[model samples]
Each structure stands twice: as C-alpha cells, then as structure tokens.
Target: MAECVACKQSSMAQYTIHNVRFFDFNPKAIHCMSYDDATSRLALSRTNGDIEIWNCWSRPFMQLFLPGDNDSSVEAMVWCQGRLFSAGLHGFLLEHNLASREVTLRTPITGGPTWCLALSKDKKKLAAGTERGYVCIFDVVDSGVMYDRALEKQEGRILHIAWHISGDYIVTGSVNCVRVWSLKEGRVARCGLGAADRKDEVIVWCVGILDDMTLVSGDSSGRVCFWNAELGTVTHSVHTHKADILALTVCPDQKSVYVAGVDPTIVQVSRVETGTKKGKVEMWVKGIQRSIHTHDVRALVVTATDRVYSGGVDTILTLSYFPPRTVCKFPALPPLGSISVAREAESLLLQYSDHVELWRLGASSKKGGKSGTFLPVTKDRVKLLELQGKDDEVIQWCAVSPKARWIAYLVQGSLRIYHFTPPASGKQPRVQRVKEVSQEIKKSHQMLWLSEGKLVSAAVTGAIQVINVSGSKAELEKELTLSPGHSVLQMTCDLEGKMLAVVDSKNIITIFDIEKETISVLPGHSSPCTAVGIHPLTKEVVAVYADMSIKEYDPSKQCYTAFCRQHLNEPSSELAKKHSVILRVSFDPDRPDLILLHNESAFVVVQKDKMAADVSQEKAPKVKKVTSGSSPGKGAKAGIGAKFSVIRRPNQVLLFSQMKGEAVVSVELNPLQVMDRLPSPLKVKKYGGT
Candidate 1:
C-alpha cells in the first residue's frame, strides 16, 4: 500500500487492484525531465544535479554529474538542437555537450526557486520557468542570457511554459490565463483563458500549445480546457481531477490530451471529447507518495514507444506501459531469475543469486485463460527451496541425481547430498541432507554420475575422485590425478562413464581410462582450457580451450582426430587479440554429432561430421613416470581449504538430457528506476491490476 504523507495506510479495498511491484520500480524522486530530440532517449536529474540519459527502450546510456557543485537539484530539463539543457534551485543554468560530456553554464538564472524549463525546436532560444512567476529566455548557442531591456518586464513567477515549434512564439502558463507572446511582438497576443464569464477557477498551472490555432491549459480548479487561436475562444472543457490539475501535455500525435493532477491520477481525453465522469475518456489513477508535494503531479513527459513519464509528491516518477485501446498498465514482476518449467514438480522455479523457488501455475497464465498466453505461475503460489548445510557456501553449480529423489552439489571441500520427499498431503516437500562425501579437492569444477550410484567429482588441483553414495558409508572408489603438476579447470566424462577428460591451466586435456586407471595426455593449447565434453554413447571427446580452439579427440584411436578452428563469424584479424575463453560445452544427447559451445559473447552449435580433419597428427610424448609437483602426500594436502555441500538444481542449463534437470522461467531485473514511478508525460499509460 502507498503510505500517505500523514502516515496513513491506504485501505486494502481502496487498492485492491494495486500492484506494489510496479510502484517500487523507482525509489528516487524525479527532478528535471526531457525526451531526446529523436524522442528515443530520456534524461532526468538526480538530487546531486547530475543528469542521466536512458535510451527510449528502457536502457541507460550515459550519466553526467556536475563536477564541482554537488548538491544542486535540477528543477528543469529539456533536449533540443542536439544538446541537453538543465536548470535547478541553484544559481546555475547549464547546457551540456552530449557527445563529449562537457558542461557550460550560461548566464546564471540565479534565484532560489527556478523549477521549470523548455527549449525551442531550432535550439536558438531557451526558456526557464521560475518560482517567481517569471521566465528567462536566452540565446543558447552564443551563451547569451538575453536580459536586455526588452526581456526584463516579461519576467514573472512562471509555473510552466512551452515553446512554439516555429521558435517565434512562447506560451507561458501561470496561476491564471495562458499567455502567448511573440518574441518580436514582446507582448501577449491573447489572455482569454480566465475571462470573467468563465466559470472555472483560472489558476493556470501548465500550458501545452498544440499548434498556432489551438492549445490546452490546466488550472487550479482541476479542470482542463481546449482553446481556438483563430477565434480566441475556449473550444471545449473537461473536469479531469478531484484536485487541482498541475501539469498538462499533448499526446504524441496531438490527437488527444493528458493531464496530471493532485489526485494522483493522470487523465487522458480525446481532443474532441468532453466529460469528467469515469470511463468517459481513458483514465488511470494510481497511488503515489511524495513529501514535497501531496499527490500533486509535478512533471510529465512522453517519450518513444507511447511511454508516459509522470512525477509527483513522492518526488518519484513512474513510467506506465500502455498498449492500444486498453488502459495503461505496468509489467508484473515474476519471480527473480529466468524461470524454467520444473519436470518433477510440474511448477515454475525462479533462480536468483542464492535462492530457488517453486511456483504453481496460475489459471490465467495458461492457454486456457487466453489463447497463446504463457504465464509461469500465480504470484501467491511461490515456495522457497532451502538447502541444509549449504548456508554460506554461495552455490555455483548443481545437478540432480538421476532418480530425482536426491540433489548433488559441490561446495568448498567435500560433496554434500540432500534427499527430497514429495509432500504426501497438500503441503510442500521436505528436504534434508542425508549423505556426505568428504574430499580434499579444493574448488571442484564439475560433478557427473558414472553409474546409477557412482559419481565422479573433479577438483581444481587436477585430481578426480569417484564416490559411491549407495551404501550407508559413502566412500571414494577411485582417485585419478592428471599431470599432478598443473591445475585443472574443467572435467567431463563420456556418456558410458568409462573415459574421463580433464583440462589443465596450460590448455592440456589429459584423458583417463577410468577402468584401466591410466592417463593419455594431449597438449598444444596456448591458453587455459575452459570446457570439455564427451559423447554420451561414443567414446569421442570434444574439447574447447581458452584460445577459442575446438578439437575432437578419440580415445579408441589413442590420438587427436580433428580441429574445427575459426568457424563462421570469427572475429577480424585485428580484433582477434587474446582468444576468448570457452565457458561451457555440451553434446546433444539425441544428436551425438551436434555439439554446443558457449563462450563469453557467442554461442555456437556445430556438427562434428562436417568438421575438418585433425591438424595435430604429431606423435605425443609418453610419460614413463608420474611425478607430483610436491609428491603425492603433500599434493593431497592441497585440498585443505576445500569444502562441499549439496546444492539445489541450477537453472542455467535447465534440461540436460543425460542429467536430472529442472525447468526454467524468465524474470526481469533492472536496478530500480525513478522515472518508472512518474506517469508518462505523453501518449499511452499502462495499468496494473488493482
């Protein structure tokens, strides 16, 4: 619920359709605001007087903070003529160079309450609306403040103002009528907004002139009215608020109108429509909290994508997501990380930095609710999966056992296993740690199952330990050490679990005959090895190293067979500096010849059959002796700081055919935004459920 300035909580009934998730989108107040010249960027002021520019697509592009002055609050902002203009309570009115990140303060519009600003389309003139009912116009390019005798009298404690597209006329909205003044004329051409015959209070708060012949204005009475420039008469009027209307703007296409008011509601009306009743014109009202102004909507600006930006009392701004004929709404937050469909539980699970959650599918989230609709689960049906004994470990990888009754996780020193039992009644499942395999292996890289009950765990110290968790006493069955001198980064076993492949820091992958207890070393890698994969059915192995090299090794032939170097979309010769490190690789279970490799910025799916023949036909060196860098007993102590605990299934590679897998769902995480709180100043408005 949105808390009132008086500290009262909004009644549940009053906010039954409210979405708190959307309200917290931005936790900061919005000062000056503007849409870019192309309307594809949004710029706003931080309390520190710095300006942050975000692409129209909801991505932040750049930030410009004032260097010397730290506490200036930007009260006004606008983008025009390829530059960003900002003014604030400080004595500074600055023009910023966007491309070079430079700042130049024009003649200081020094005053205590400068709060509003606008720029002409041609970029020749700048206007600052101030707290004293006056506005200052400057020649922007020349850095001239234009304070000649001709410009002094027009100054008043102006609340809001707008520049004509031609840059010849200026419209200033005060506590009364809309004043349209021509620069050359130096006088108001019309002031008919508050004629004696008009019934509404004439405290004009904001003005948005649509064209030379028409304009719109909002006043203290919470009423909005359209005016005809040619006739100098009010054309139509609409009661848009329960309180005073503070800000007004024309829709993107100028076919309709939008007004923000003290009621915390933004009213949209067709230019030709008139009425204050509900559903008369499209309308959206959401609770807003700001201390400086009570629900008093302050700023409004519309940007690309029919997005509307509104700011108010809470000092917060909101961005509304409105589609076509539907009222404006906001994006509902799913659980945290990418969600995937869970197989055993038949639910959607959310994964984050340290948590895994299960959520029951909601009725509306199914195809049954709407054709082609994909909803993960109901927000209220979420459950947290807490792993015992894995409290401070910060799990990095996890795999479920084949049976799905147990989960295997590698922590620090040893392998810890947890057993899960499905709920007998309509309750959550109970999970408990029932098995542990202690290994002196520090920083385990990968863990895979050999047979139904046997598992292989690879450590960073180039050692592999085979553990049997079937009996009461969990114990290691086999221990194989790679060079014993180099560090192991990754390891994987063939589908039959007979051959194990381990890659060391020197990019050398040593193949071990698990049954024979022997090793075959393959070298020639210039970078640290990152990923290795073995065919499930075939004894063939595919290794991808740090130099971005991919090779196929055959154990049966006892040699390297083929190399697929520099496949399609390879980087340019000059740009291909240090090779990219391969992070992960996997072979398709159904298509043995199809391999997938994931690197830092690229994902490649290749067919092994089409790969070129091995370039490495050279005979490899044979090691007649196995010598540990510091001897076996001393190397064994390398696992001193290693620790392990079973972790819940990870969502990264959701469903690996050969491994027990979980489902995945999608969630969004863009650090909280302040503009997401304000009502979009222009076209469409989005709505969230009550």
Candidate 2:
C-alpha cells in the first residue's frame, strides 16, 4: 500500500509494534468481514461456513458460530443488530443471529457468487451483486426477506459498494465502471469511468465515500482516484497498491483513510494533516499480518470502539486499537457529473464528456469500481463531402443510375458523372472524376446515361453528343444535330439506360435509340417542351408542354396522344392552358407507375390509366351563372328605381389539343414564382377565367 499526498488525516500510532500478534484458533479461509458502528461488533465469515463475532473494545471478546453448510462460498457480509447476512456463491444468502447462533436462510438470488453486497446506512435494505453482472436489492424485514429491485446497466458483475452519506442512494463498481443509483427512483443515477481511446483499458474495483457528493475508487492497477460528484473532475490519483486492492474505508474523522491488500504484514495508515499540501501524510506501517490471521488476509473492518478488525484465510479474527494522525496534500478529484457507456466487440466503450464518445470495453474489472476509459468527440473525427459548381452552371438536377453506383449531375451547360463506393465496402466514401469530353457541343443543358456505357448530352444549340464511357477514357462515338431552330432543354433516360428522351427548343420531344445511335424529333406541342421523362421499364417517353399538357410518344404507332393535362386553363383561347408551365417532370424512381409534375402554382400526381381518363373526360361546363336583373324596392330607394345586370363567364374545361403549326414554337418559360410580370396574353386570359 502507498500513501496519497491529498486529503490525508494525521493520526498517531497508539499500539506498540511489539503488540502485533495472531491467535490461530480456527483454520479456514476468510471470505467476508464487516463492522457495526452502532454496536462496535465485528462479524467475520470463515471458509467452513462459520462467522466470528468480536467485541472490539474487549481484549479477548471473540465468539465464533456456524451459519450454514451451503455448497457455495461466502462472498460478502452485512450486519444488523444481532443478525448477520451473508451472500455466497450460487446466490446463497444465509442469515444468522449472534445471540443464539441460529441460522436462517432467505430466497436464492441470481446466479454465481455474489460479487458485491451493501446494506443501507439505516439497515432497512440490502443490495447484492451477482456474477450475472446485475445488482439485486432486497428489503430487510423482521420476519423474512422481501424482493426490492434489480439494477440493469453494467454488462458484467458488480464488485464494490459505497453508500451515499444521506443513505438515500448507493454506488457500485462493476465491469470497469462506477454507477450511482438512487433508492427513491429505483434507477441508475449515473455511470462513470469512460474512455475514448480505442486502446488502453481500465476497471474500478473498491470505492470509498469521502464526502456527501465525493468518492474515491481503487482499480485493478492499485490506483486510488478521487472524484467529485457535483463537478466532473479527476482531482488526483495515486498508485498505492502493488496487487489488487481488496477494500477501502474512510477515516473516522472523515479526513484520513485505510487500505489493505497483498502486503499483509504492513497496515498503511494515511493521515491528512495539511490541507491539500504536497507530502502531507506522515506515513507509518504496522506489522499486522500476524495479528489479522494465521493465513492470508482477505477483508478488514473499522469498529466504533476505535479498533481495527481483520479476517483472513486462517479463519481468525484480529483486532487492534490504533490512534489517528493528521496529514494533508492535494484534494481529491471531483465526482463525475455524467457518463455514457457503449458496447463494442469484446470491449466496453465509455464516454465522460459533455458529448458521447466511442471506445472498446475492456475485459477485466477490479473490485468493480473501474469506469472504462474513453476519448473526446470532435468535429475532425467526422468528415464531409461536398460538390461545388460555377456561377451560372448550377446543378439543375441530379439522379442516381439504375445500379445506384453512379450519379449524374445536370449543370447549367454540362453533364457530370460521379461514381461512389458501395455501402458493403465499409470504407470511406469517394466519387469518380468525371471526364469532360463534350467539346463538340457548345454546352449540354442535360445528359442521360444509357446502356452500353453511352451518354447523350444535349445543348441549346440544337446539337447532341453521344459519348461512350465503357473504356477508362471517354470517347465521343456519335453526334446528332437537331434540325435548324431545335435546341434541347430537358432530358430523361429509361431504367435499362437503353433509350433517351429530350425536349428541344421547340415544344418537340426527341427520342433517341442509344444502342443504335439514332435520334428522332417528334413535333406535337405549340409551346416549348419544359420537361421530359421516360418509363424506365416500358421505354415510353413522357413529355410536358408549356401549356401544362403531358403527351406520350408511341414508338410502334409513331404518333402523339394526349396523356394528361391540368385543369388550370383560362378562358382566353389564345392563351395556353398550363399556368406558368410544368417546370419539372420526374417518374418515381421506386414506383414506376407514378409520375410527378410540378409547376409554379400546383403539383400533379399522374398515373398511366388515371392520366388517360382525365384527358378523355376534359369538356367545358355548359351552364353559366349570371344576374339577369336587379330592381330597387321602396326600402332601397325612395327616388328613381334602377336595374343592374352582371355577366358570369363559363368555366372552360381543358381538353387534348394538337400542335399543328409550321414551326413547333417552344419557349422555356420562367417559373411564375420568379417572373416579374405575366405575359399580356396570359394576363388577359387569366382575367377572363371563371
């Protein structure tokens, strides 16, 4: 054992060194020991299932009795009045009375040996830790035992215990963790000892309550660390034990402490004389190994009579009267405010900062007080990926390829491909470098990836570039220039990437056979074709006209048909029916049957069959409502009476129409939301609408 330089109490040695001796009356292993502050009586558990009670004030007041002959070994001991509670392996709990030496047994607990045991300060409840790595609380009654609760947090066994000063809560060390639990709430208050690093692991074993909201724990490495509960801080740490620390106890005056372990011969007395000053403890060691027992010492207890009681493998009770000394050094670390625990492969992860962190949980835990170690969570740990574009060359739209491995980005005047790593790889994300080879075309407003690694790029200059990307290097295999006055604007591709459909400067859609490298422009609409999409599985091209009309191009019939139209037309026959035009058209990637059409004022959901029915049913309402005449009565007018009339316009139903003109004039109408003013024809038509 070693002395801590902080929070030490100064105590002088009262007993002489010559007095250290042991009386070997019994020969058995000691499992657990305890002291009753109220009665000044100390209880000791022996390997043969016997408990030895000693009156610390008396020189030779020691009595031994058998509790039970259970097969399991005793793990912990708690005392109340003349009764003793013992937790043993295989969930064995035996109660024995010192007065009559009568043994009474309670219900079986969980599984394996009880790793930790604690009795409330008032002796109203008893908590037992099981090898199953969970905590069970039992209420202590006069006649028998009653079930209380179980704590479910730590993934391993609990090994240490320390009750809060208020007797309202308790903390236990288990599986490299220190957990605080509230008796009133019946839940975990906090868990500590977290690590962020992926490597070094630690566990907490024995814990001692230094004050109301402060405690200290000794881990497997024989390190004693202090923590404050209110403020999360590790004030100090001292390596005090050469072997695992078995137990910890606070000094009577609440200033000093006593620790015992493998070095049985020497009992280290740590006294805090100076307040948080370095080298404050006046260190002294007493040869109490022989006095504790004839065998290895396992447990120790401090009695109210100012005497120390020890139990060991020799099954003997050792007592000594020792005086205290004052020693002082640095203060202990503050208690941890919060803790986050996570489980990783074979290791437990712990986080102790304001934010949660990730770590691997280690295997071993000392006496149970180890809060596993963890690292901090920082922004640098997480990376972000972003793609930027030029001022006017904004990314108008984006679509992932059929395989979901490649993404096609449509810019103001060009197309780009980005290849991404699949999720199965479990590696950092990366994007492919797009090879720009569209020099033949001034600029592509849109592009689509077709089958056989072919891409069709459309420019506003009535030119299209068909490039093949099957090879590592991109090659312009074909170029298709549209007729004069025909420039492409929006485009789409089918699911198999076999066919490409694009809307040109005029309200005409051009369907191209990617494999055959052929393009055909189908003239059908009077206004510009604002958007284009295709049925991925069916290879059907869907075109949206500036008049809000959807037309499908039938490849076998080689004819245009009214697919669908929005009922948003004004009364003026010259004005187009579609308000502000359909700016975007897309087919549901997941549901091939659904099509989405969005414009400035409204959005439309179109299905193949429903769209056909909507178009076929388009017809003007016949009746028109109008005020024929209004006459003034006597209450309305005492003078000359007058008649008034109001005219109501008939609602015009939008139906299928043909775009038969010399040149299919198409214009990319600006979305109404951003348009400064409506066209004179459109404004006049809107005023004439019902």
Query: Across residues 1-690, which tens digit of lDDT does each residue of candidate 2 receive?
Result: 000001000011010000000111123556678887765556766665546554432222332333333343667888866567888775766776432234556677865578678877677888887777767878888986787777664577778887776777677776567777776887777667645562755667677775556667766666666666555345556666555556666666664555655434324435334434565643222222222332345676765444555655443345555544311111011011111111111111111111122222112111211111111211111112234554334243343333334445544345566554433457765656567554564454455556435666665455677776642446677777666766554466665666777654344677877778766666565544556777655566677654444566655456554342342222222113322344455444444555545433222444454333445554533323222111111111111001101111111101111011100101111122112231121111236586
Q: Highest lDDT: which candidate?
A: 1
Estimate, for each residue in 103-215, the C-alpha lDDT of model 1 and write its tens digit: 64555673446767777777767777676656667766555345422233443466777888877777777755677777777767776547777675567778887755576
> Please, what is the whole-model Cα lDDT of each candidate in the order they appear?
0.51, 0.48
lDDT for residue 344 in candidate 1, whole number 0-100? 38
Top model by TM-score, which number? 1
Model 2: weakest 10-residue lDDT segment is 1-10
Quote the RMSD, in angstroms, for model 1: 21.1
Q: Tell me how many residue pairs clash in candidate 1.
A: 55
Query: How high is the lDDT of residue 678 in model 2?
Result: 18
Question: Which whole-number lDDT from 0 to 100 does residue 39 have in model 1?
Answer: 42
